[model samples]
Target chain A: MAEINLTINTQLAREILTGFIQSEITRVGFSRAVVGLSGGIDSALSCVLAAQALGPENVLAVRMPYKASSRDSLDHAQLLIDQLGVQSKTIEVTDMVEPLIQLDPDMSKVRKGNLMARARMIVLYDQSEAFKGLVVGTSNKTEILLGYSTMFGDSASAINPIGDLYKTQVRQLSRALNIPAPIVDKPPSADLWAGQTDEDELGFTYEEADKLLYLLVDQRYMPQEAIEAGFDERFVNTVVARVRRFQFKRMLPPIAKISNRTIGYDFLYLRDWGT
Target chain B: MRLQLALAQINTKLGDVQANLDKHLGLIDKAKKQKTDLLVFPELSLTGYVLQDLVSYVAHRPTEEDPVFKPLLAASHDLDLVVGFVDEDSRHRFFIASAYLSGGKVLHVHHKVYLPTYGLFDEGRFFAWGDSVKAFDTRFGRMGMLICEDFWHASPPYLLWLDGADIMLFSSASPGRGLGDNEKLESARWVERINMAYASMFTSFVAHANRVGYEDGLHFWGGTTVFDPNGEELAHGPYNEEALTYAELDLNQLRRTRARLPLLRDERTGLVRSELDRILSRG
Candidate 1:
């Protein structure tokens, strides 16, 4: 009889990152972590993990909020920085963005969104270059599952601590870590558009959607059976449909199988060779 | 007699064992009505592979306890069937097994080895690798099973062939790649090329069953196909989507080809010995 292998638990996640960071630091002799603290749960969790992995002084939280973003969002960002006792700064995106919008007011929402996401990423990357740190990602499995994240935008991060866990699970873990309550309870939003909520734009609440999806795709429940088991039929079908609809968001750009060794499906990329 | 067998490349979501079983039954009925010799399916088709860590549990429903097997057993009575699912025994570790059914009974089960444990794929974290490599007694002579990565390596099935595996079937859930124009893709051309080379070298028949359709971020490439002893592509399924391509295999050709090639006959037993090196190197 063989024993079951262990997974990456919270303790393990932290331990894995700690060891990885220390080895990387020693290998290069020194390294830091730069995080974009959106005052959101994802970024907050990332910041906390980054602080523990690298020293709080070594962890830099850059808050890049736009002018249209509410004052409460900024306050919440400060609240987290003050509570965590990490080095923080405000790099408001208003000045950087106003010129871009003025240049192309007729540009589509997608174009604007892409610009906004890229702008934040550019700031984080620039800061990371200045401080010689890695950009830690804050995306949860739910966003990654639904292809809800922008590639190279918020989606671009060096190492994601909470990428596998769902949004609800992220909140649960955040509570376990003693993060501020307001951030946990706050309605999740990209703060992408004014008066926008993650749930509203996504057409369902994170709690409602991620669970049903977890059951259907992750748990392998069929449409009728999932509904019989107390999931909304429409919601279950819709979420399953969307996951099928947007399969591209989670994968690397497809390289045709012209050669024998392609990128993902065939070609092997073995980790831990030097180790 | 030549047999035109179709390997049903269907989608199996994680944990929805019942739905996958239903799909199996439906495909079996279709195959039986078409008068096909057999219909093969992907590994873990009953309970979807990549069940996070839940697949690590070594628990299986017995013939009586497993309601999912009921329809499958009934369907197999009408048609020769090969399917994949979770099977458990004394090994506390779970097994990715392929089941061969006939006359309403599961005749044999081949547990998978070479469980992948890297990147997005994590089979080793769950099931214990299969140790045995014996070919089963089939109506079509001695046949063996290699689930997914088992066909990737040279050791396991090569040993099975030495143990009288004239026919080799690989049940897989090979992930799909998408083109820029938004279409499902069948990839891992390298795996097929190398696998076919071994089959041709060994003078054996090889049939590969890959699951089709999308599940979450992963897409199952339905490139089911069969290769003759000469490594010719006898039949190939549609890329990135579902299609049950059928091929007629003449078992008599297997013996005649082995005689013609004489590679298997002319092999030296002592030189390039695999097992002896392992024992000697362990010291």
Candidate 2:
């Protein structure tokens, strides 16, 4: 039962994240950001940070709700938009995903959910061009580690402000940033269907997942060591398996080495190369 | 005698040598206006820190004939300067190096001895390791220069102290990482603590100049600081921003502090040399 201290100084985190968003975006000659505000804590925290980095007017918070999305989601998103005074746009993604979803009658709910998530990505990228802003990501570390996110769907973005934060830390930062109570306090969900909560689907609370993942990932604990530290052996194995299985989603597609200077193999340069 | 020192905490453009050189010239001009006796910039200030493949493209020789050093040498006619750059040897091997220019002459050049190879650092892959650690004479007295990771180990600064360096100039492109309940970043707190410890242990002035900016994803926190021989912080730059922080070091304090502490006088170099020789021979 070795407890991991995942607590961060909210003020310091806020400064670093805001500075990160601003520097990453502007260094590439972008003055604005487009964030998919899902009315969840992760996206809300990201949107707040983007608005703080690039001014409120510079942040374009897009709400792309599917037909099955709860009214609370839309309302909570609107609450943040109004509070931050940032520009907002609503694009209903029902028409976009429904046609493809109807193509295969036996399409699993998981497939349907991924389609919806990706449909939002298309809309956000399109708006990024029209609005002259980069796409800001909202995927938190807890879900990212557990392979809970759809690759290139909710995960694709030009810059991510909170990708390193755990879901619990996201909630902590949201509260510190004075995010609306309903958004911060509500159960986490992807809202791909009528009633879908993230924890209920994942079979574990974010607090439990975050604590375990912190030990296994950040602290670099072995699975056997984690089990000895009071985490259930089955839980440790399951989490480790998920992390291992989803490793591909965390990185760029590997390129085969052919030449003496192969991109990503031997020809290495930072993304800020020559800037 | 007092030394007017300026820590030019700046954000360098990655791989753009000309742009960064222009920045250095501008900072030198400003430091001259302030009557600063010496100005120190962060490690790789002339070329950004995260240069993976761009290392050779931006490497320069610190000579009067070198294009990059020509203007910097001309600027040094007014005020002394400590600038970091990628130094290319005659054999074309590159190094993470810093040069001390005074009176229109390159006084000393220190290639970073310890190229941090693991955990977010790839200096070993790109640059050749520097072999020597020697202090040189300046108008202010004897001074030593160490790049980012060089001062992290105890030996570099210890060697500088033994070589009669009364002032230690440390430059870093130190990225900010690890946050805790403390207000300061984990990297920042540790660096400041070590700098102060070095100053107190060696009874010498220690000035650290760390850059600020985000390159790729790494953020270089800029809390450049100066500590007197008594380990008291004299000046501190703002965190995560660019600024030219200044501190007036009363060089006489080195003599006064050493008079009371007497650690330098009591140092046993012969005993340490014999012990190190014995340990090496056993291996």
Candidate 3:
């Protein structure tokens, strides 16, 4: 782990994923892959890569629809199954999740959202146990950056193929892979609540917002420059505000810097421990 | 010749090569307007750092006629340009690098030797570590170039000094969050102290340029600065602005100071590398 000399790129990424699958399968003695297909581009691209890297017979796509999920989402889930020809099943969360919600109907939206995300993960893991497969991830770089997705829910995965692709890039890759163009272009959502869309909840479009983000956050433009660059002053302020506000989600839990090289402090890099 | 240098602290989008090129071009025009002698930019200024796989496209040493180097060539017909980029090498693995251009010819290209991979950085993933330590004879002086993290390591700078570098340039894309007001000030002091140590040791003018922007969720806290041979701050840019600052460097002052101090003349280069290598190996 000492000074690994180089870092992440596409070739290294592919090699790492391919090598990881090979090693994980041999080391853990698991041969199949299971994924929660949300009829979203992230999961679709994951299945395509997993089925190709692993085998189609070895990949299982689980369509876990909730009570509030759009009917078209379910139909699109079927479209992905037909397009990829991977083994899949319809696991309605109505029976499972509703019981917990009924038991705790007074839970806040944040708690409920976390519960739904973890619930989907539980379903994926159970299916993995039933099918003896690894749970492939559907989270992409865009969601990961904003900390928009649930931590243990959609955030946890055995391995993530699309986690590196931006949401727009995911759509691009989806089209190239011949995934349903509608699903690729469709507005993203977790379908955790009724009439929910990611943008509506995020309060900004990914394309426009990411461009502004690239300016304010990435370009180190002061709030003034971002506002001057034709970005909505209010939107720029809000996004920049949120980005600074949630820097914690991107970092490890805060630790007391008691030691010379403390975790989350000076020992941020593995080089501290490496030769 | 005393050259006016503009450290164009640019914001580059990952994978948008043409757009990044245009941005660099715009900044070049800005530098051109300033009538700068050298338009220096941050490391990987053309393409934002923390890219996933696009470096593979830049992995090959495209012929000198490649379209990528066109803008810097045209940016100023006569002004010297020092820009940082991902240059493809023979192995098809890119290198973290700085290219100096003037008179329509790339004068010198310095590839980074230390590829940092731990923590949030993954420089080791895309770049092949460069082994050569060279001091290119520029029109200004015998200048040595280092990429980000190179100055942090001792080997390259010691080698550069031994190779007779009269001036050194380090380019960086350092990410910092706005959360740390206390820690930020402390780290800036640390950088200043470290660079001061380098300046004092080498007794040469040191120029450090860091990008000011965010990319892939990482923010570059640019406090680009220069120092005289006596560890004296010559000029420092604002912490978070895309700015250009110049310092009057009297090479004769450094020469007289070094001669009076007799530090460089008495350097013991013979035993340094071997001893350091032994210590590194033991660790």
Choose 1 or 3, whichever is better by lDDT: 1
- What C-alpha lDDT values do all the predictions have? 0.73, 0.94, 0.72
Give the Å shift of residue A6 in candidate 2. Answer: 1.4
List the pairs of residues colliding in candidate 2. Answer: A1-A229
What's the DockQ of model 1?
0.02
Chain B TM-scores of the candidates? 0.89, 0.99, 0.89
- Candidate 1 lDDT over residue span B1-283, tens digit each: 5766788887664666666777777777777777887788888887776665445432354363467666677777677778787777765657788888877787778888788887567777667777777788766677888888887888777887787888888889876431211122224566567668877888888999888544434546567878888888888886555677788898778878987898777866566587678878999
Output per-candidate TM-scores for chain A, rounded to 2 decimals.
Answer: 0.86, 0.98, 0.78
Which of 2 and 3 is the better model by TM-score? 2
Listed in order, the DockQ scores are 0.02, 0.89, 0.02
The docking quality of candidate 2, as DockQ, is: 0.89
- Give residue A166's error in model 2 in angstroms: 1.2
lDDT (tens digit, per residue) of candidate 2 on B1-283: 9999999999999999999999999988888899999999999999999998999899999999999999999999898999999999999999999999998999999999999999888889999999999999999999999998999999999999999999999999999988777899989999999999999999999999999999977999999999999999999999999999999999999989998999999999999999999999996
Off by over 4 Å in 2: none
What TM-score does prediction 2 earn?
A: 0.99
Clash number for each model:
0, 1, 17
